[model samples]
Target: MVISTHKMVDCTSPVDAARLFNAFCIDNHNFMPKALPDFIKSVDVLHGESGTVGSIKQINYPEGRPYKYAKNRVDEIDVDKFYCKFTAEGDVILGNIEYAVYESTFEPLESGTHYTMVVHYHTKGDYVVKEDQVAVSKEHMKNMFDIASEYLVTNPQLYALKQ
Candidate 1:
């Protein structure tokens, strides 16, 4: 088995950290499909409660996409600190990859939110992850963040932080 790790720390969103965190890590099941209907079909909780640790979710993609669905299990989450960690498997990691672990952190900033993402890819047997695969994954992650940020910016009251 081979493991590859990638980290991206310079991403920033115009939305506030709490709101972005709510949309991405906590309420993604409701927010993602609504924000990007053509890309994401739906997110269903398969086990445990949504937004909680140990919960597993199945993210379904729209037709014509490369993959149909992917299952992700929430390994850790901290609402107060705006941190979350999850592991993705199933169709998303088919072929040479065993699974991929993702960790995200949203830090509040004066202008917006500073976002960071780390991904750990575990490959099957002696297979090594290619640069193109990592590039594609990073692009997908950035697109998701951009889409969600735009949606939240347009609808400010959607995921507003509570007092």
Candidate 2:
């Protein structure tokens, strides 16, 4: 079975939006872990070097959390388009599904920017994925994006300079 979810968020500026999206693509170590310390314990580059395709980033959660770690591989990335795709390979991600793919895109808007996330869940044979499970996962996903958005908002000067 296959399940899909789509979410969209508005940001302050096009460059900031693209940078925020790129931050997740490359800043799990310095930005995400630092900005959202409560949820993410740390992000270690387990396999390949980060900031490039094929790199694997492992994220650790706090103790007593639902899952311990999630290992995601950078499946595809487009710098020009400000989009990225990751394949989640961990117990939490593949628990009720065969595998999961997370895709994020940052696009320019007239006044600000638009960020969209699409999650595709592939379930095991003869198995069904509950909505509640997907909801929780979606919330988890939202928290990450919210934190990154907050970071970009609070540090406007920094992102503005990058633009």
Candidate 3:
């Protein structure tokens, strides 16, 4: 299923948008309270380069109480337009997922900036044929976007330049 979420940030630059995403990814105490042990080993382009396309991030997941070791790959980075596409192929809730793209566009609004995050994904494996389950997936996506927007807006220090 494809889920498109629209939101506006009270800012005038893409740097602020990227800062929010980066802060959310790295700042565990605030953003990732549910997954405390989760640590990001490295976040860089896949092929030893940096740019918009082919940007990849390697996340390391050690064995936990009920969680198993896993790795996620995030590619298709677009710094100029402020977007990136991610595809995970491993022991994830949804297997064989493809085209899991997340694109964020920031435009200068009259008083602030408009930010939109679009996510396109589809389920795989045995659950793929269960067409009726699409609602559940869409709901999850909606919840994710809501949480993200809330975080970005509520935490002004993220893009405030000064701590």
Candidate 4:
């Protein structure tokens, strides 16, 4: 139960690359990741009901971090091209989470726009692996897609909103 999928592309627009990947996953509180010492109280959607789709959010897990109650479910929403697919339940980050899909695709690249990003997740655990563990879990999914494509390219305004 270890499935990892990550992809990235950019120039922008599937609605500004799905609103910069949904504001880099709900405005990650500056993100540090190491058990979050000083801060990192990110994740807030609270009750989504806008634009389109089933739109439902209520994720706020940062009590102590590490697989806390992370709720998410906006199954599939397609705004002409931009997309949002999710299916998180409780304990996130390598728990029984499945069907975590976030997608985008926009093309018009002669000098700009050409975004594409995807993440599909499915994993549950009891634990029991020996042989190489799928090449160290695909090198930790290429270091989590190179730290999420270097935090979406060094935080493009944390997914742009500067019009």
Candidate 5:
């Protein structure tokens, strides 16, 4: 079975939201480790090119985490739409989910932007996923987005373009 979860956040600038996502996709290695050192040790580009579609990321965690590291692939990216999709691979299972896809889209608002994030969960066969189980996974993903959003909102220079 498949399950999808979505959440949105309102921001003051579409550039901040879109660039925050671009940072998440590309500079996560630089920022995530700094922002979430307690949980993430480092994010290394294992294959392909950094920030490009089809690139693979190896996310490492500090000792004693459930999984030592998780691998994910960049599945889709639309600069025009300010959208991105990431597919979780080996050792990256969230709750009972066997496959997870995270898609983020930045929708422009009159004042700023509406950031919508969706996570599609594919379960391991033969059984059903309970409501609580899905909620747990969804909350986990939402918290992640919140953390990123807060970072961008608080530190606009992180996503600022270089001259």
Candidate 6:
């Protein structure tokens, strides 16, 4: 087996950390599909309660996408700190990967939030994950974050109550 880790940092958002975290991490299951209908079909809890540690969620993608669905298990969550860690597997791994662990954080700044994500990919056998593959994954995540940020900016009251 081979393990590869990639870190993406300094992604800035003009939104508050709490609000952005609330929408992106805490309420993503409810908000993602609504924000990006063409990309995400739905997110359903398969085990445990939603938003809690040890919970498993199945994220379904729309038809014609490269992946059909992915299952993620929440490993850690700290609402106060706007941090979350989860392990993803299933179709999203594309067979070559056993699973991927993702850690994300949204830190408050003077004018916005500083976002970061670290992904640890465990590949099957001796297969090594390439940089370009990681780049594509990072780009997809960035696009999603940008869209979510734009949605929050447009509807300022959307996740304000969650904070």
Task: Estimate TM-scores for all models.
Answer: 0.94, 0.83, 0.48, 0.26, 0.79, 0.94
Task: Score residue 72 of candidate 2 by CA lDDT.
Answer: 86
Ranking by TM-score: 1, 6, 2, 5, 3, 4
* Alpha-carbon RMSD to native, per candidate: 1.4, 2.8, 7.0, 15.5, 3.0, 1.5
What would the per-residue lDDT of candidate 2 be over residues 10-91, giving only the tens digit for each residue?
2344345556765677666677777788888898997887857899988898887878988889888887787888888786
How close to the true structure is residue 112 of candidate 3, measured as C-alpha lDDT? 42
Tens-place lDDT digits, model 3, residues 1-163 = 4332322122233335555444433332244333223432223333433332443444444445233323334465555554544554434334445334445455444544455545445544432323354455555444554555455566665546554
What are the per-residue Cα lDDT tens digits for candidate 4 across 1-163? 6655655333343234444444433333233232232223444455565333555454454566565555565666555554555565654545354445555454444433455555556555633333353454445434543455456565555556567
lDDT of each: 0.88, 0.72, 0.43, 0.48, 0.71, 0.88
Backbone clash pairs for candidate 1 read none
lDDT of 1 by residue, 93-154 (tens): 77888999999999999989999999888988998887766777678778877887899999
TM-score of 5: 0.79
Q: Candidate 3: worst 10 consecutive residues by lDDT?
A: 2-11
lDDT of 6 by residue, 131-152 (tens): 8877777788888889888888
lDDT by residue (tens digit), candidate 5, 1-163:
6564534332334445556666677677788887777778999989998778999989998888777888888899877777889988667575667877788777766655676666666776654555566566566555766676676778877877686
Q: Model 4 — which ten-residue stretch has the worst lDDT?
A: 31-40
